[model samples]
Each structure stands twice: as C-alpha cells, then as structure tokens.
Target: MNKIAIIAACFIAPILILVTMGIMYWVNHNTLVKLDVACDSQFAEIDNMLKRRADLLPNLVNTVKGYAKHEKEIFVAVAEARTKIGSAKTVKEKSLASSMMDKALGRLLVVVEKYPDLKANQNFIRLQDELTGTENRIAVARTRYNEAVKKYNTKIRSFIGRLVAGGMGLEKRDFFEIENPEDKEVPKVDFES
Candidate 1:
C-alpha cells in the first residue's frame, strides 16, 4: 500500500502543476487579447469620427470659398490637408495628418471670421457644429483606446503575464499617441463676433 501511494504521488504531482500553469497562461492570454480587441475597436471609432469630419470639410471649404474667394491659399491648404488625412494609412500617419488638418482648418476659420456672410451662413454653421461634435467624439475614443492599451501593456509585462505571453506568442501593443502632442492646440474660434 505504501509503495502504491508513492508511485501515484510521483505521477500526479508534475501533471497537476503543469495543468495549473496551463490554466493560468490561458486566462492571462485571453484577457490580454480581449483588451487588445477593445483597444482596436476604440481606435476604429475614432477613425470613423475623423472620417466624418473629413467628409464635411469639402462642403465647408466650398461654402467658405463662395464668400472668401480671395483666401485661396487657406482654401487650398484645407483641401490638401483633408486629402492627406483621407489617405493616411497608419495610426501615426493619421495623427500627424489630423494635426495638420486642424491647423489648416483653424487658419480657414480665422479667414472666415473676416467674412460676416460666411459666419452667418446656416450650412457653414451646421457643418462646423457637426465637425466640432465629431472632434469631441474622437477625443473620447482616443482616451478609451489609450486606457485599454495601458491595461494590456501592464499585464503583458507583469511576472506571470510575461511567462504566459512568451509561451503564447503575445506581444505588446502600441498606443495611438499624437506625434507632436504640443502642436495640437486648436486655435480658438471666436464666432461670437
């Protein structure tokens, strides 16, 4: 009886340890993957909002052009910025393009201020409002994405997570951060005048 018990213990001990380790690894890997999916979804939402804003730009430009024809340079810049933003393929590229578009749009808005007719145009005002709302949505989505990435990165770098990730081929994900964060200051548009 004593010999049989010892034999069973020797056979079961390593197997139990391995099974527990496998469960731990699976749980960690699944959690990380879930977080990554959430991050990707958030980024997609942000991209959609940006695309909405981009779609609105041409109409806004056309409306402004009708009144501020002399500001050809501003109009051209806005159009070019929109084109670049539409063509951006990666998150980093999109961020840089978005910042450029914001600057160009700011300049366009400044030019629009000189034209009272453009300022009061209902279509222009409506499009501006829509763009503003989209920008707010983008900001919220980006915040969520960054938060998800932070959680995922923290997990993958932890002790047990490191082992799990290494065995499961999981890698850290990059946050969709602004390229030139300091340059993101959108010029104040005082349409009150």
Candidate 2:
C-alpha cells in the first residue's frame, strides 16, 4: 500500500504540473492572437475612415476651386497627397501619406477660411462636415489600435509570456504612431507671428 501511494503521488504531481503549464501557455497565446486581431481590425477601421475622407475630398476641392481658382498650388498639393495615400502599400507609407493629406487639407481649409462665400455653399459645408466627422472616426480608431498594440506588446514582454510567445511565433506589433515630424510640433500660439 505504501509503495502504490508513493508511485501515484509522483505521477499525479507531474501530470498536474504539466496540465497547469499547458493551460497557462494556451491562454497567453490565445490572448496575444486576440490582441493581434484587434489591432488589425482597428487599423482597417482607420483605413476605411481615411478612405471616406479621401473620397469626399475631390468635391470639396472642386467646390473651393470654383470660388478660389488662384489657389492652384495648394489644390495640386492636396491632390498629390491624396494620390500618395491611394498608392501607399505599407502601414508606414500610408501613415506618412495620411499625414501629408492632413497638412495639405489644413492648408486648403485655411485657404477656404479666407472665402466666406465658399464656406456658405451648401455642398462645401456638407463635404467639410463629412470630412471632419471622418477625421474624428480615424482618431478614435488610432487610439484603439494603440491600446491593442500596447496590450499585445506588454504580453509578449512579460515573464511567462516571454517564455512561450517566442515558441508560438508571436511578435511585438507597432502602435499607430504619428510619423510626420510636423505633427509632433506644437503650433505657435503667438498671433503676432
């Protein structure tokens, strides 16, 4: 009886330990996968929002062109940035192009600001409103994407997660970070400048 009890304890202890380790590894791996998926989906949402904004830009540009034909340089810049965004293949490229679009659109809006008549145009106002809403949605999606990336990166960098994540082929993902240097700079508040 003593011999049987000793043998059972040794076998059961190892089996229990093995089961616990297995479960922990699985849970961690699954969590990383979920986070990865969330990041991808959030990026896609941002892309969709950006696409919506891009799609609406031409009409806005045309409406403004009717009022301000002299602002051809700014219009061309906006068009070029939009084309860059359309042709971008990678996340980094797309981010850069989107930033360019923002700057170009900012210039366009500033130009548009000079003309109250254009602002009052029903179609221009509607397009501006839609672009603003789309920009807001893109911001939301970027925040969510960063959050997902944070969670995923934290997991892969943690103790137990580090142990199994490499074996499972999980890697750290990048946040939807701002790539444009100008975007990082604080605008001069001095109206005198």
Candidate 3:
C-alpha cells in the first residue's frame, strides 16, 4: 500500500525464498553424502570379515594336511584363492575372489569328510567352528552392504534425490549380488554326532 512497505516486501520476500532454497539444497546434498558413507562403511565390514576368514585358512589347511597328505590339489586351490583374495583391490574383485575361495574351501571340506579323524580332531573342530562363524559374519556384512547400496542407489535414482545427486556428481551403486549359481549353494558341513 505505502512506498516503504512496498520496498520492504520486495526485498524481504526474495531473501526468504533464497534462504529456504539454500537450506533445502544443503539438506539434500548432505543426505546423499551420508548414504554414500554408510554404503562404504558396510563394505568395510564385509572386507574385514573376508580378511578374518582368510587368516584362518592356512592353519586349517595345515591341520588337514597332516591327515590327508595326498590332498595336494585342495591345498593348492585354497592357497591360490587366498592369494587372489589378498591381492583383490576393488569390491567386485574381492567378491569374485571370495567366491573362488568358497569353492576351494568347499572342496577342502569334502576332503575332510573322507578322513574321519581329521573331521573329529579337536584342533580341526575348533578351526571349523571359527570358519563357520566367520562365514556367517561375511554373510551378514554383505547383507548390510547390499542394503546400504540399495538405499544409496534409490536416493540417486529417485526424482528429488536425482536432481540433487546429479548436481553433486553422485551415481547409483551396485548391490553385492552373487553372480555364480554355485556360490549360492549352502556348504555341506553337517555330520552325524
């Protein structure tokens, strides 16, 4: 209505709009970053679990070797898989290596089955328990990693998040999917007590 009132309205309205937009942008950007960080954190957990499993392999191999000295192929397969896992750099590389290690470990378990004493040995039993626990941990960690990746991927692909993520250079991430059908099989560890 009045000159001063009109001038104040013009200045304040734009400022308020600009401030609101700035806050919205900040929130969206931060959400994207936090989701990305969560995915990375879960990936680290998977890597650590894999490392723990790898550490137990050598001892288990030696213990079994004492009983099944002729089973050199299994030993070599496990050794090579462990080496591949250690040398892996990316998440995908590590995953493929893990699958290789799993197949090798599965074959080793079969060899142990053939030797009743090796299967019953106290040290072997303890190592088996530890390896089983570690495998469970790896499974859980991979689940969490995939969940985080799913959330992050959704955020980057959705409408509002897509706009923000694109401006921030964020991209969708792949889930920790098991590509090999053989790797999906449950390991045969059950035996009559």
Candidate 4:
C-alpha cells in the first residue's frame, strides 16, 4: 500500500523469480547430461557383449564346419553378418546386423540338426555354451540400453524438460530395438538331442 513497500515488492519479486528460474534451468540441464551419459555407458556395455558374442562365433562356426562342410551358404552368411555387426556405426545398423546374425545362425542351427554327431561333439558343446552365455549378456545389456534411451528421450520430450533441453541442444536417443517383428523372438540355440 505504501510507496516504499510497493517499490520493494516490485524489485524483490523479479529477483526471486529470476533466481528460481536459474536454479530450475541448472537442474534440468544437469539431468539431461546425466541421462545422456547413462545412455552412452549402457551402449558401451552392449558393444562389449556384442564383441564377446562375435568372438565366440568363429570358433562355433569352425566346430560346425568340421561336420557340415556342405552348408557353405549358411557359413558365408554368418561371416557376413558378423562383419556387418563389427562395422556398424549406428544403433539401427547394429540392430539390423544382429537380426542378420539371428537369421544366419538359425539356418546354421538347422544344419546342425541334421548332423547328430556334431551335436555330440565336446568342442561344439563347449562353444554352444559360451555362445549361449554371450547371448544372455547381450540381451541384458540391450534391455538396459533401451531403458536408458527411454529415460533420456522422455526427458527431452517432456514439456518443461523440452524447454531446457532445447536451450541445451539435447536430442532424443535411439533405442536398441529389434528391426523385424519376427526377430522379436530370440532364436533358440538348443543343441540337445
């Protein structure tokens, strides 16, 4: 009501508002950066698991090759898929390459089905076990990476977060999704007779 009181209210109100806004912006920006780092870390875990699976493939291929020499096409396809996975630079590319591997390995497993002796081979058994373990690790890593991406994307797209993210130039991250609907089902790697 008084002149000095009104003047003080007007002056202090804007400073309080500005300080609150600055704090909110800082918090939002930090959240976005932290989510982004989490996405990167989880993706690295996926890459490591993929590399482990890739390493197991060759030995498995060799073991299968000793018995199924005539299945050259499947062997070649597996090799090419492995190469694509290694050379992939983006999330989509990696997903496609993984799908390719799944298809190729499925065919390879079908070939193995015809050869009873190969299934019983100790070397083949060991390689299959290692490959199975690697696949499980890959699945876990992929799930975590996707969860991180979901959080990051949600933050960047939310109303309040979008404003802060836009000012920070933050972008949505891609999920490690299955390229094909059929690929959603993991290929069974059972070697039991």
lDDT of 3 by residue, 1-193 (tens): 6999999999999999999989988888899999999999999998898889999999999999999999999999999999988888777888889999988998999899899988889999999999999999999999999999988998888887898999988887877777578777876655685
lDDT of prediction 1: 0.84
lDDT winner: 3
Could you tell me which residue pairs clash in candidate 3?
none
Candidate 1 regions exceeding 4 Å error are 167-169, 181-193
Task: Give the runs in model 4 whose Cα sits over 4 Å from its true position.
Answer: 184-193
Per TM-score, the best of the predicted structures is 2
- All candidates in order of TM-score, best leading: 2, 4, 3, 1
Worst 10 residues of 3 by lDDT: 184-193
lDDT of 4 by residue, 111-143 (tens): 998999999999999989888888899999999
TM-score of candidate 4 against the unseen true structure? 0.90
**Model 3: CA > 4 A from native:** 2-6, 185-193
Q: What are the TM-scores, per candidate, against the unseen true structure?
A: 0.89, 0.92, 0.89, 0.90
Q: Candidate 2: count the clashes.
A: 0
1 versus 2: better lDDT goes to:
2
Q: Where is the poorest 10-residue window by lDDT in model 2?
A: 184-193
Candidate 4 shows a clash count of 0
> What is the number of backbone collisions in each predicted candidate, taken in the order shown?
0, 0, 0, 0
Q: What lDDT score is found at residue 106 in candidate 3? A: 84
